[model samples]
Target chain A: MSDTAQAARAVIGDSEFDRDTAVTLREPGVYGIDLSAGWTIINAVNGGYLLSVLGRALADALPHSDPFTISAHYLTASQPGPAVVRTDVVRTGRTLSTGQASLFQYDDEGREVERIRVLASYGDLDSLPDDVRTSVKPPSFPPMEQCFGPEDGPAPVSGSSAIAERLMLKLDPATLGWALGSPSGKGEMRAWFGLADGRDADPLSLLLAVDALPPTAFEIGLSGWVPTVELTVHVRSRPAPGPLRVSITTRNLAGGFLEEDAEVWDSADRLVAQSRQLARVRVG
Target chain B: MSDTAQAARAVIGDSEFDRDTAVTLREPGVYGIDLSAGWTIINAVNGGYLLSVLGRALADALPHSDPFTISAHYLTASQPGPAVVRTDVVRTGRTLSTGQASLFQYDDEGREVERIRVLASYGDLDSLPDDVRTSVKPPSFPPMEQCFGPEDGPAPVSGSSAIAERLMLKLDPATLGWALGSPSGKGEMRAWFGLADGRDADPLSLLLAVDALPPTAFEIGLSGWVPTVELTVHVRSRPAPGPLRVSITTRNLAGGFLEEDAEVWDSADRLVAQSRQLARVRVG
Candidate 1:
């Protein structure tokens, strides 16, 4: 096995099955799985598990696929808990390969959990239609060299939560000296994300990694406390190789709820992915 | 008027702009903005524009006081459009007198074109805790009687586009309904909904209405198309009111380049609204 693959397996397996797993195949590049524990607690399977399994199967079905960069967007857990995943390739087209997978979690009695349908495609990146336009821009802030890491200073009040600490440790204010790429080659970035534990993870891990950041980011900006009810992300493209930097902005928040949308850009200003999340606020 | 009140008027008009002006005062209630245009062409002014304005203002404020409801849900301009609405108390919470309003459209020059918001609260209804649940049941098929306005031998598709005709005319074999009040005396609901026009509209619109289908009567089944990019709903109780039903599902074409989410729902088993949408699909 390659060193990269070995390292990935180590981190994922070491972490209580919390990270997404990717497997490379000759036909469609690489496949991945987003696993979870089901609500039954006894069965050890759930909704997210099924979706992750499905994701992996889809990835394996494509031809002319890029093994270097493959991923699945948001796969949700309809019913909470640990779940198992399985994948299968649907078809391989000239330009694109299609794949599907199923997520299964058990009920209290060890019955099958709800199933989720997984769909994925692989191939040369396609250009957006002439009419579709992105209004998001890369965020400008202090560079990594000048910024303080979470451990470098006292953690922010919001950083008290484990999720918050994980986020702060993964993100940098600026994107200097990072590899970048995007379909448009103009407005997104990706970098080698430095985790507190000193391990590098994939885009799916990065997503789980950053999910808790917006609330912290926003809370610090507002100088208050904000709790997120749920967070959802849409991956447009993967970040280029290197330390990752994410550019985000607040779209809108109403009815005690806040929505923040982000355009994840590679260091080269390419649109790697787009994410949006909803959060509930707790006033001081 | 207070400084905040006066400043608000400068940007929006006075509270008494029009009976259907779209913006109304309601302590604790969210502000409403309606964006609807006459048939031929529905511009952003009626929807996106209004949301942009209301979203911005709401962001500046914190924790409102009045209780509000989303009475209507549909599609416009092939996109998801939701009106932030507010309700004002007529009897000051004594006898349950209240008024509601919303701003629909904003012209190219940023003026409202079509808008609607309603005000209501259980008048003389018993004061209760957050103990309602949805008892409403979904139908096994479309409620043709309530949806077609009586002269129904199967509703005719009415729209300028052929695509719309196929969608509006094709009836799905599914049931739709909604239950109001609480099942376990908790304010919740179970609802079913689908397209009034029968054709698909936009994913975002379908999601918005599905998310806004009030609380279910029991453990309301939350299902829809589009894989739910993100979903967030809040309820004070369970068993909301009537058995509101919504039906939504979709199909993708062109190697999944584009897809749609279709939906329909009944108010008291009566057709209330319908929606459809387009989306970008990725295969994994």
Candidate 2:
């Protein structure tokens, strides 16, 4: 790997999200990430991690600088290595800019295949005018001290994926019915999350934070990794700067697939990020 | 105009959606839409109409004919003209296939510029596994007879955009607080909808139907066409062949932006589609 690619891979393996998202802007609309092997879920990487990589590029590429909303359509699985981020600005307004980006890598034959394509709007959070707020509220769960992650609860069989080890998780214990060999029967998980590397919650980290919770479908008795096919992330507001409180809920698990909706609130109780994805359902 | 362009333009102007979405699949991974002028929301075309066009490309691009989920990011505002739809298949499984599509139009300079980029998953709704369904029910509204659309709605002082005239909509009278010179102050609208041309609700029409309702922010007094920044449409199941029952609600109107969640039920009373969008909030 080139020194640049090696450096990006280091960031991906690093636990500090700030470090992970420290994407090097090689030039206009070109950002590169040095992806490490540890970020892999099985062999291919976790889609959310790649989203953060692109999110970092997007936040820097535009004047708004905040990923107010982003959605990624996974085209192919991105392998662990040097990957390139390419972006195009469609329309830039005083408030928001419309753009699209692709995360890609070249095969040994020198052909580029994009792994993900994102259409996003970057905006300044401060510019949003206040309106009559709605009554939608995040679910209240016990604070961080009362939560336990997959490792702290029912340990996965001996060899867990390295990606599992890298995630610093704290899932609410009350929702861990799956740990007792009995599933909650409801695909939902609420927890407090941040990077194991201790990076504070920022726009890019918030993107990763929403997807960090183990698939809510796991508690409902499904097995295997439910890879996200398409994900839509709505950055409601900037986080209050802390480990985000997250709720991942799957309303219906049907048709060999399911939809997972995530709500992420900052410590101050402000809803910071919301995301929904359609994923293939593997019934184990 | 060439015969092909004229034929395509006719489809867009036609009120019938099934025929409008009959995108010409020239070959695998390629579809085309003859653009027409009436779909414009003011000078720029409505974003939702573009999505349905892409949805048509996707459903036909894959083996699974039903559009289970689609999310679109508008790159550039497409004018009324000829556009090519190109799709790239990422993964095609027996049940669900993951893919991405781009709609491109040539500029006066003859450069191909993308107008929309979409990531979607195609699935057979019938194959969804049964689960403990949620009890969250739809709101009880007066049957379609009590609702009235914009024409029957508070008459626009003068020339309204032709796009408004093309939609056959009727809002449940209770939610039209803005019409009385008194805003409901709450961002919500429950309405019954169908295309003025009388198109049946399929996956693509269902996509347009959710966006068909006036932005919920309108009821709360926000004015000017609030353009959709990003839209994610999840087709929970195929819609029954009829006009859809739509309930549009904005959970929180903050930072000059808000999230609109739409639940569309078919005549059979089954929830056929659900969508969420992030749109600009313009205070009147």
Write the residue-wise lDDT of candidate 2 on A1-284 in tens digits. 12233233333334345555567888988988877676666686777788988887887787778888888877677888888899887678777776778888888897987788787888887666654375577787887777776556445521256665656578787667666667788878888776555446767777877776777777877677687778889887767756788898876664566778888888877888888887776666
lDDT of 1 by residue, B96-140 (tens): 222323334355686544332222121221242322122223436
Candidate 2 chain B: worst 10 consecutive residues by lDDT?
Answer: B1-10
Candidate 2 residue runs with Cα over 4 Å from true position: A1-15, A24-31, A40-44, A60-64, A105-113, A126-134, A150-168, B1-15, B19-34, B40-44, B59-64, B75-115, B123-135, B150-166
Q: What is the lDDT of residue A105 in candidate 1?
A: 55
Candidate 1: residue B278 lDDT (0-100): 26
Q: Candidate 2, fnat value?
A: 0.62
Interface RMSD of 2: 2.9
Per-residue lDDT over A35-154 for candidate 1, one digit per residue giving the tens place of the 0 to 100 score? 432211223222222333443344445453321122222222344334555455544546444443445557779986434433344444343332222333466645666554444545
Residue A186 error, candidate 1, Å: 26
